[model samples]
Target: MFKHAHFKAHTALFLQATGLTGGPGAAPLFSGLDLQIPTGLTAVTGDEGTGKTSLLRLLSGDLSAHSGTRPATDALWLNLALPEHDEATPEQVWSALQQQCPRWSTELQQDVTEALSLQVHLGKKLFMLSTGSRRKVGLVALLASGATLTCLDQPYVSLDQGSIQVVRGFLNDMADHPTRAWLVADYEADPDLDWSSCITLG
Candidate 1:
């Protein structure tokens, strides 16, 4: 398991949302949705039209909910596929994240980079890499961020079989962590993972 000495103290409740709705004008995705997120591996599963990504954004404080108590936490949600990062290389992104994330782990970053076979792509720009490779870059940063709460949207999507296993292994190792939570939003929870909580939307 990845080791970080300073663990941020938290209540049993890592995150709480009450009566949460998507947006102002949009139809309510789930009305009066109450959730208590604890520290551990959490799987948010739902159909295509469901608000998985929106819920993650709300948790990460990237977007405001229509109406609810969705308090923000020290969260990390990296969407590196944006146009602004197209010209940036993985090495550049890693350097930037290291400066931004106070608890960043260089050891974890190096280990994950090797496990995912991403060393070769670090020098290439984001646009020059394939979809899976780009996602791996984001995964590397996310895993090493050591944020209080880490939100991963469709983490396994577009990943190669080997890389997928690497990601899964890391999450499995984090399943019983004392602090820090990882919220993975996907279509369905992987049966192999020991999820502490599972939220189903749709």
Candidate 2:
């Protein structure tokens, strides 16, 4: 459980689309969409093929909108999908995050890594680790990042019950942050989570 604190109002992300289209002959996902992500937690929920993932990718600048323009969001952090790195060890990935992500915090990294019980698999290569372990590595980096906006796509996937609980707590803790905004996109909403706002996409 997270400590309840005063909620502050701040806008960390703004998205607008006059007409956005992609996939299968450029079908439009959403048109005239406007979203303002303020400080706190927001949940994006919808069924599969509803463009929940696509919206996150657009926000993260991983996918381009066919029509609208999004402002530069260098401070945004998202962990939607991880590319296969067969030869990379969890330890190696951790080291790379230290150098690549400017907002990476050592203290936060240690806390998340321990909470996720990722130490046991740090020495193992990506190919050798279980799906849960691999996700933990990415989860650590995502939590350690001190970005203004953090988007997590299906974060609970492949996680065991214990790890899922840990991540829920971590996300709750992050939701209390004054400057950071947490956005989650999933097939269904976690009933345990206290979302400040929710958008159902289709």
Candidate 3:
């Protein structure tokens, strides 16, 4: 649930000497690398095809690293691509997650739903929402899950300014409120968030 960074800073996450292989027994994406991601907003940036998404997957515990160790973080993972199909509304998303994850409380679910302003979207269909709305839904689910760690890949992709603001605002709120550790990977991170720590890939 917790680990330490190289500087002795308390970290909830650790990716140590980790390696990743692409495709069926292909070359490694990352090898023999060690890293510690804090429990806040952290950004990762790289050029197209730089395995940024792959890295996010590793953090979410969805993909296993070929070698090395990642911090043992009790985290909730949300993959923006190929979203799951739920016949329920966005409001229902939180409730559903709560039901699915017994660790979540009623108060926590309500807090996330209300904070994300997802109250009105309860009756709407997941497919009916705009591109931005879909991404917002993903964000709401991640923030409210109380998983202690959040790893999002390309959340702002294919969204309008309003949707982007919605996402950015949520991230900003996380920073101010300072809850769990969050890692966001985007084409270009916002300067306002002090996310320059993002590892740059060739």
Q: State each model's CA lDDT, in order.
A: 0.83, 0.70, 0.62
lDDT of 3 by residue, 62-116 (tens): 7776666666766676643365654557766666777655456567556655655
The residue ranges of model 3 lying beyond 4 angstroms of the native Cα positions read 1-27, 80-88, 99-120, 176-179
RMSD of 1: 6.2
lDDT of candidate 2?
Answer: 0.70
The positional error of residue 161 in candidate 2, measured at the CA in angstroms, is 1.7
Which stretches of model 1 miss by more than 4 angstroms? Answer: 1-11, 24-30
Give the residue spans of candidate 2 off by over 4 A: 1-25, 75-83
Count clashes in each candidate, considering only residues at least 3 apart in sequence or on different chains.
Answer: 0, 0, 5
Give the CA lDDT, 0 to 100, for residue 168 in model 2.
93
Give the winner by TM-score: 2 or 3: 2
Each candidate's TM vs. the true structure? 0.88, 0.82, 0.73
Rank candidates by TM-score, best first.
1, 2, 3
lDDT of 2 at 50: 77
Which residue pairs collide in model 2, if any? none
Give the C-alpha miss distance for residue 136 in model 3, angstroms.
1.3
Model 1 has an lDDT value of 0.83
lDDT of 1 by residue, 1-202 (tens): 1111222243255777777766424676556667788878888888886778877887777766777787767898889889999999998999998897999999999999999999998889999999899999999999999898999999999998998899999998988787778889998889988777878777
